[model samples]
Target: MFSPKLLLISAIAVALVGSILAISSLYANAQNDEEKAVNSRGMGYYQTTGDVLDPAGSSGSASTGIEPMKYLRTFNYGRVSTLPNGTTLREFTMIADDRQTMEISPGVHYNVWTFNGTIPGPTIRATEGDLIRIHLINNGTHPHSMHFHGIHRAEMDGVFETINPGGQFIYEFYAEPYGLHLYHCHVQPLEEHISHGLYGVYIVDPKTPRPDADEMVMMMNGYDTDSDGENNFYTVNGVPFYYMHHPIEIEKGRLVRVYLVNILEFDQINNFHLHGNLYHLYRTGTDMEPDDYTDMVTMSQGERAILEFTYQYPGQYMFHAHKTEFAEKGWTGMFLVKE
Candidate 1:
């Protein structure tokens, strides 16, 4: 009952409908694929697809369990407090987010934005399973936050929650599985924030404290004089040639514990070397046992170590980065051992 021309038109219409259906299905598939990609890469507060609770796994951008807070006992110091609940409570506060000129080396000054007006904020210490609270006030012309190497709720992790100038923030978390860690301003242009000295060391001691010893803290850092993405002057504990000029005094035959942290930016690697001794090294405080016995250890940026040694004899011993240029640039130090 249909003419030939009508049959041709009908076939054409059917083909058009099929093409439309095919295109619609393809488009839907593409949307699903994009969603999957986003989920895999993580979105928003989610930094990784891996288990966030795993304190031993590596999460994206964060050290997670591999690399590495806070609470209401209002405090301005960096020490651990024990709670009746078997949890240790640690508290800290930092101020001064504005820029100021600092003496990087002897007669060499650079403008730095500091926490508490120091190049390396404050050294914080605590025991494993301790709860920590940090209060931060921003007095500079920028927004910033404190990001630590610990496990915590995503919202409490301190990223994306920035405190603007004249503002403040409270960060709290538990210190898990002891280790030497770091805290820094995680704001954008991280290089600028960290390089300007808004960083510090965090030490989480083991439940059974390592044998009593003479404990000390040393941190390595660098200053970029020209803002050229390369460090010009290297320092330990904020000043260049400080230790070389005023060597650390120690008692011979006494166990010495050193919490060493490296916060140098724009450098490939920095290191610590002792001229006259070897040390039992804990490459982070995670292990109950020493990781190795060595004379020198190399650390990348933000890495830390716990070293134990006993000077067998009383004398002057040298310690510094093995990188000769860094040493020449004022990273050298000495330990004066006495009976």
Candidate 2:
């Protein structure tokens, strides 16, 4: 008689083979589609009144010199809206697209999938108790969805709702318990999606509001250049050694607040180290009181904190991950203080 273990192994192998074959066929089709000749449309302005009325005797041809009838707005970040009754409404329209062989630093290039053509796409800002409405347009060739780490309803949750190509969805939620957060594509093969640069920083300011200070967003991310289940290059924003080349300028005797976020994949722990300074750290930005005061802080994947500090003396200061190898690999930056 055949052993039960042998039969189970045989069943698993057959299922794996079937799945591989299906995926291979899909890839072949996608390759073919990418090779098709695409007609380029000339840029022109057209009147859009939300009506489908066509011009008289107009032929559907590129030579017509008429642009497509669609509502288009400038791609930007940190958009806010307010009602007369003291309520705030934050709105954002995100377009997910993929670019081929985009430059990471100066000479390094990677196939980057992006939102609004930028890695670590636009930083979204909102105040506590405000409502956020995100209009996600799936203009790319694959399915995508936005999953935000905030309190929201199940339908508003992007996990079970995958929008196909040319589809759209509206995600609305109330921003509560203000803190540092992030948003990313939550489709299947989640790691691949995130590694492709489909993530961004989301900030919810506290209700009572901290003291006025110069603020900046620093999102830690890494790229798996060889697809080898390891990150070869790491960055604070998107480019390697960007801040090292062009240090962020700050004024002396002024408060500086940083929204620090870590979304680096394949790494369980990433820490921040500041040279010649200490910060009042607010863990997760959920409380009014700081949890500690220190020069270095560590966070696991998807963790964040709000760090506030002031430079008493003016000089150039460096900041990087405590993991020396990570800083050498490109996770580094500097703060140039002015007298």
Candidate 3:
């Protein structure tokens, strides 16, 4: 007379418990036949498994270890000043390096190429019509270059600006068409460079400037662990499920502006969704007008937009990609609106 559904669930639970115990006991029965730690061969490099071949946990060659929370509000404003002709000049420096390990998830790691030693690099911000000067140093064994997504002269284009290892280049251009843009290594084998993590957000504020608000940058990206064409894990700000563990704290009833960018390689499109609110979507942030008032937005690789919203009540809300496969894999987060 017991309910059939209840009995089925009970049986499944018991079977699951038994399987877990069996798997645990297998390790206990495992005996070491032969094991040896291979050392030497004069390889002074890091691997994707978070191992520094030179010295164990050496601070000199250690990874940046940038946590998601710390990188959330980080922005690079550069040295700002006014030119004699009444224009803003922003000077910035970036170093390109390779053979750095970063954990994309718990116990999961990858060897990442970096700009200033972070996956998504630094958020470079400037005002419209400003003279943006970037000094790029190539410290990696491979040549690298920065191709910015904004209006600039042909000579300043990155394709021909590739810098050999131990070299440097100066790229100066005017920030035109105020919007949320992006930059990445444009060396040959472009996809390989970008997939290895040499990209960042570029923000050029409007001349009039947008309203005051809590602004944040979210760059949608992914990590391919197996050298396959498909991505194994996706992330926001370079860490999977980071916001879910440390929900973004925001004040209730405050305007929140998000400069969202989609730089996910191996995927045609990516998206964002909110659980309990809608936002005004500014496609590419080129104009002040909004193109849509919705809770979700889909963007292609290199596509970016600006979204503004306000949380009414204080609580925790989930935000993630509308694509179920992505959310289940890693493209998910939470926002905590505190009273």
lDDT of 2 by residue, 75-139 (tens): 23346778698778888999887544576655456888777667777778788888889999987
Question: How high a TM-score does candidate 2 get?
Answer: 0.75
Give me the candidate number with maximum TM-score: 3
Count clashing pairs, candidate 2: 0
Q: How does each model score on lDDT?
A: 0.76, 0.77, 0.86
TM-score for every candidate vs. truth?
Answer: 0.75, 0.75, 0.81
Each model's total of backbone clashes: 9, 0, 0
Tell me how candidate 3 scores on lDDT.
0.86
Better of 2 and 3 by TM-score: 3
Candidate 1's displacement at residue 51, Å, is 61
What ranking of all candidate models by TM-score puts the best one first?
A: 3, 2, 1
- TM match of model 3 to true structure: 0.81
Lowest lDDT sum, 10 consecutive residues, model 2, at 65-74
Model 2, CA-based lDDT:
0.77
Error of 2 at 317 (Å): 0.9
Off by over 4 Å in 2: 1-86
**What is every candidate's alpha-carbon RMSD to the true fold?**
20.5, 19.9, 14.2
Off by over 4 Å in 3: 1-64
